[model samples]
Target: MEATPQAPSPLEETQRSGLALGLVVWVFSLLGVLGALYARWAWTPHSVTVEGASIQHLFDVILAIILVAFVLVHLLLGYFIVRYRARGSESALYFPHHTALEVTYTAVPAVVMVALSVAGILLWSRVHAAPPPDAFVVEVRGEQFGWSARYPGPDGKLGRVDNRIQRPFNVDPEDPAGRDDVTSPEIYLVVNRPNRILLRTRDVQHSFWVPAFRLKKDLLPGATTELVLTPTQRGEFDLACAELCGVGHYTMAGKVRVVTQQEFDRWLRQQGRR
Candidate 1:
């Protein structure tokens, strides 16, 4: 009698099971993408919430393109691989690059990239442009594990601050700026005014990050850095220490309260008097 055709062995069966699992995972991933798209569409904030959220439209456009491209490419590749897997007497055919295909790929990506770059530059310029003449200035000082903020007391001029001459809570007697400029740990800002933060650190490198405003800047020891932000929303936001300093890094946090101009003035006066 002729030999019966051999059935797939246990090893082959196991291989098939793994392949099936991989396909199932890919399918679930696709479903997850759909769910994410729905969530993003439903949850995207129309009114900008943070400084970075001002460019939310641009970000959404870029993200949509990336997500769609990824899903399409993966699905097509997986389908082709499964449909054209190796079989007896069949071989794979490779095609050389076509100039039209190459040009289309390169030009499309180049255009998209250029558009994104231009949008980014425009947004950056808008964000960095000098504030209006009526903008407010607040001096921000970063130390080992805490943040202190100082506002110009009614004069709109920050008097002076020298770390070496100034004590923890006391101003120096000799230096003019130190004598006049006062520092306070409680930071208060007025709503509807452009605010500029002059950031400085005393001990080590630290980053002052405010998530609600989407503003962050690194404060270097012995040097001053600056950040300008406008709080459109009036509320409270937690300040996170973006950089690692030492043992208490995890506990280093601050509170930011955006209040009405009247409320801010009241608080400033109360804090400064003490």
Candidate 2:
């Protein structure tokens, strides 16, 4: 008769399980890192506004922190899983807790969060503080399935708009300031000049998003919102409605054209004639 076969030791089984789990964790973590890197390199849009650079910088800082923490935490977790696997007949160590470790973990995250909050607040203030005295102003109105832009004519003032009024562009027929208002299907901005965009909605909620400018503002029904940015480059960019309003949400799109001051003025004149 053949000699009786012996079963594998508990320690060997534990080692195999620990090694498998650790390998899985490490592999997934690596893949996640690679995917993030690829997306950042291939998908991030170019910054075309002064504020876009700052926004991108803040994003990079935040992403770096998150990726670092993610890698470190996973690395340590995998290491612990394999290093502390159960050994047969060995009692488990039960050193309840370490005060230093707990405090370090809590305090580090708290400090990091506070710092990030402060940075965000400062950036917000700068973005929405105030437009320059001579900043170019345009009004963007959102309706279901489309967007419209209104430029103040030579009057340099946007006429009063009332949602209650049933009229083209909702312009108050009584407000003389609106008479010269030129409405367009596209937005026109002057490169290298501060632009103040007034956002409004006709029926439901909508969001005005210009990816290249790194700005997104909501067009809330019955209310007005504002966004200010200075285009540093002159080019045509795509504008999108970043909200779901109705069945035709996907079709609500527009174009943003940044041109020289002279070109913008000439275009305004041409639009006013129409």
Candidate 3:
């Protein structure tokens, strides 16, 4: 039997409502993108250090360029969709691929990648270069859920520490270095000085992250990892565990306090006397 055409009812109203809602969503999405671009461009720089300023400025430029390109691409795409929508009597045009257009697009991106890579490498080298002779050395140990730090005394030579022989709240009876090493829950450092952090994990992987300083390094079991950071600004920064540990992943939070050399010394002396 031939099918009969159905008359429109409340169901047709529902369809229209859905279409209107979809349009609203699309428009809001475009506005959301614009808002994000504005926020990124107008963000204030909080860290006054050179390294921090460089990172913020670099990201701002990169994000602005990306947002502009994104906006242009979408604008052209929307225009094409409306301009070339199917009509009752018209057929679609067919064209062969343009080699010139492909080459131009590929070359531009290649040139951009090369420039970005060079700049990244230079920044990395600046952060990871070997510390000077007077640089402060600190050893960091990661256990299941906490960080323990050890600072070499005034001698500047890190007394050796073997975790196997070391006990909680007490130094190992065997390792001689544990006698002079300063261990604490708080990882302290002297600002405006070259500081090297030696990282190690006892059980699983952990990451030493200080967002303010823009520094992060993984802490692995057995082997020791190291990263150099010189904090030129003095303030309190949040340190988070970058790697996913277990159910306690969300609770792994650490504090980073950047202070002057004099304050650091006072804190160190107080800890030593304890």
Candidate 4:
């Protein structure tokens, strides 16, 4: 009797395979969730602007929703795969219709999408709204391999700029408003003060990005764009072009210095003198 042992049935083998695959999927899904959690907690950059915290919060909310959906989807998929695996002499079940299920899935996602869209629109409106009357103004010009900043001097008015003028800051030399404009290689912002930046490009398209500020705006050739922000921290941060313009794209880098109002004023005065 002991020597008459037989092979396992096909049904038993199929169940075992399904169970193993399901377990693998679950394990991988958990690992992915952990990795994302770790990245969110440890790798996220600090927000240094007044509006950056709100932006980060919105991003975190989106990520959390996505992760929740991801986990639920994978878990359900694994369960379905294991529960519905083919067995000997067994046929798959077919449903003629599932109205409630269909409506639930469709409505839930549609509602969520609409909610997120509204939130994004509100945030965008607030961020791009007209700058305060006393907001500091600066012009950021992008060129082939570098960045330059122009500040309105004592008159507090950025002069007319003609792309064809081809001068520093493109200031129309004849425009009286541009007579005291100050140009610099780096952008200087005043802490706790609203700053309005006018964006322009000399050639190809470029993007002005400051990670700490959580702000990025595209600079299109022959057109002007604007970005407004209020810095809450006083420090130097890296500014880089996010768009790839040409071979020298990687070399398009600059500095963003945030300082106290007094310091910013002194720096502007010194630059104007030079």
User: Model 2 — TM-score against the truth?
Assistant: 0.92
Whole-model lDDT, candidate 4? Answer: 0.90
The CA lDDT of each predicted structure is: 0.73, 0.91, 0.73, 0.90
TM, every model: 0.82, 0.92, 0.79, 0.91
Ranking by TM-score: 2, 4, 1, 3
User: In terms of lDDT, which candidate is strongest?
Assistant: 2
Residue by residue across 123-201, what tens digits does model 3's lDDT show? 7788677877877778877776877888877666666545564465234556565566777888777688877888988
| Pairs of residues at least 3 apart in sequence or in different chains that clash in candidate 3 | none
Best by TM-score: 2
> Which lDDT tens digits does candidate 1 get at residues 1-274?
9999999977567557656755875787698788878867775433323355766667778888888877877776666655554444556888887899999989998999999999989888887777676777887777778888867666666665566755653345564544445567777666667878888777888998875565578988777788777777787778878999888888879987778888977777776678
Off by over 4 Å in 3: 1-29, 38-50, 168-178
The residue ranges of model 2 lying beyond 4 angstroms of the native Cα positions read: 1-10
Q: lDDT score, residue 117, model 4?
A: 94
lDDT of 4 at 274: 69
Displacement of residue 5 (Cα, Å) in model 4 is: 8.9
For 1-274, candidate 4 gives per-residue lDDT tens digits of 4786778788788889998999899999999999999988787679999888789888899999999999999999899988888677778889999999999999999999999999999998988899998998999999998898898989999899988997876789888989988888878888898999899999999999998888899999999999999999899998999999999999999999999989988888888666
**Number of backbone-clashing residue pairs for each candidate, in the order shown:** 1, 0, 0, 0
Clashing pairs in 2: none
